[model samples]
Target: MELFFKYLQYEKRFSPHTITSYQTDLHQFQEYLQEVYQLEDLKVADHAIIRSWVVTLVQKELDSRTIHRKIASLRSYYRFLVQRGLLETNPTLRIKAPKLAKKLPAFIPEDAFTQLLDQSEFTTDFKGQRERLILELLYGTGMRLAELTTLQLEDINLAASTLKVLGKGNKERILPLNASLINALSHYLQLRSATFPNNNSSFLFVTDKEAPLYPKYVYRVVKKYISTVSTANKNSPHVLRHSFATHLLNRGADLGAIKDLLGHASLAATQVYTHNSIEKLKAIFEKAHPKA
Candidate 1:
């Protein structure tokens, strides 16, 4: 397990959050092996025993998604063990995770999003301007919070109205910007320049002290604005991203284009937004239909 973590960090270059999740999943599997089978170590376990362990996990009432993640972790771990000569053969090769049900992602309505942005307090003050711009960019670009926070000054092209974002797996993609976002960013940059006249930091968004903005700060700002405008659900940055994708899909945007905009690696990852759009269509049809 330790070597697997090293591989994830050094070879795979996984983000800290992903590494943490892998750790948790593998730890749970190890505990199950210890408690159920009384095994001192998993290196000597055979394929049949591993299959039974998966069946036991299913019997524990775990959701399909969680079970699937556990299976993925085990697959990686066993492959590593095989390469290192600790295991003779992979046990997870024949094991299959149950299919997960398609569930729609939660998103704020268009009107609620407008209300949330309208409720944001914009001032000439540096912090106020920075906060407003952060919210605007998240909703405008549909970028993950980590992508936004890691944005550098050179990543944004004001003249072209586009941004170069570094996404999952260290992939780089270009995302177009709307006029409204461009204007907001310009105003915020002017304020940022005034606040730090000669600073060397290249980050687009910065704190009052001229330091790079942290992810938690962005989350808190989003939470504050969301609390005032959205009463239906707990507001977060990801919800805004979901809204961006859903809104685009409803407007007849191509699935491939949406996938590119969201920086998703596969169409399957981008298809979750379609479920939300379908639910919206169903709601509209129910309201407009006159049949008894």
Candidate 2:
């Protein structure tokens, strides 16, 4: 497990959050195996044992997507072990991931985001300015929360109105910034300078003490503001990202362009936003079409 973790960290260059999730999934499976079957070694485990673990997970009422992720983690681990010659056969090769219903990504209403920015009262202090900028950047740039947290001062090009993002799998992409986002970032930079006069932090967003912004702080900030504007089922930073992409698609932005903006590895990943757009089109058609 340690060797696999090192592989993910250095060789694969996965983000810390992803590495942590892999660890948690593996640990949970190992615990289940120990508790139920007294199995201390995965080398002796077969496909039947793995299938039973999946059944146990389903019995625990875990979501299909989550169960699929856990199974994927096991498959990766076993594959790694096989490559290293430690395992004779991969136990997860035949185990199929449960079929999941196609669910559209939940995004904030476009006007709702506008209302929050225009009507909401934010403090004039540094903290308030920084928090507001964080929201703007997330929705404006459509960058992932992890990408936002790792944003550095050097990544911003104010004159060009672009932000260079380090995305999943350590892929780099440039996202153009809108006028509103640029102005907000300018105000935040001024406030940041005043708040931390002697600070030399390279990271773009920082805490009150000038430390780098962690994932939890970003989540809290997004949730606090988004809850006021939306009653979305999931109110996280990714919701803002989803809003960003959905809004673009509705406004006639090209799908391939959106795929690039979102830093999706393939067009299929970006095509999901089309589902939401189609739903909106259905609503418009029902309202406008004369046929009852």
Candidate 3:
């Protein structure tokens, strides 16, 4: 199990968020096996046992995506064991994840973001600058929370006005930095350098103690500011990301170009934003047409 985690972290380069989810799923399944089936070893669990766990998850009314990830985590664990010749066959081979219902991504309106950035007052001090920059990078580049948290100083190319992002599955993509973001980054970098003169950490963002920006802290910072601009239920960093992609699509950005900017493995993942665009069109039509 330890080896599996190390493989995920070191070899597969899974993000902290994903690794945490996998950890929770595996632990829950292991506990279930022990209590319900009197099975101590996951390698000993058969297809029927795995199917029973899936049925239980469905009965509990877990979201399809959550149940899907749990099954995937277990399947990966067993596959790892089998690849190393520890197991004879994969028990999860016959398990099928439930179909997922389509859910449109939530995004902040463009005018709301405009008011948030232009109307809201952010101090010039290090803390204020850092918080503002967090929102800027998330919405400007559409980077994931984990990617922004793990961003290093070396990832930014001031000369080229580009940012090299290490995305999922250890893939790398370069995103163009706009003028506003570039200027904000420049000011923030100066403040960070002056404040941490003696600190040699390479992370782009840091806590007051100069430690790398952890996921929870970043989440809190985003939530705090986003709450002021919008009263939506989701005030997380991901809402900003969705805002970024949706705004771009609404403004006529090409889908393939958006895909590369977002670092999605395929167009299918990026296509979800089109639903939001269609909703926007419907909204505009209803306002313009007077016929009931």
Candidate 2 residue-wise lDDT, 1-292, digit = tens: 8999999999999988899999999998888879989998876788999999999888998999999999999999999999999998899998988899778899999999999899878899998888889889999989999999999999999999998999988999999988999999888889888889999999999898789999999999888888997877698999989999999999889999999999998999999999989977888889999993
Q: Pairs clashing in candidate 1?
A: none
lDDT of 1 by residue, 121-209 (tens): 66768888787888888989999988898899999999999999988777899989999899998988787777789988998877877
lDDT of each: 0.84, 0.91, 0.92
Candidates 1 and 2 compared by lDDT, better number: 2
Model 2, residue 251: distance off in Å is 0.6
Ten-residue segment with the worst summed lDDT in candidate 1?
Answer: 115-124
Off by over 4 Å in 3: 280-292
Using TM-score as the measure, the top candidate is 2
Which of 2 and 3 is ahead in TM-score? Answer: 2
Q: Which 10-residue window of candidate 3 scores lowest in summed lDDT? A: 283-292
> Best to worst by TM-score, what's the order?
2, 3, 1
What TM-score quantifies how close candidate 1 is to the native fold?
0.79
TM-score of each: 0.79, 0.94, 0.90
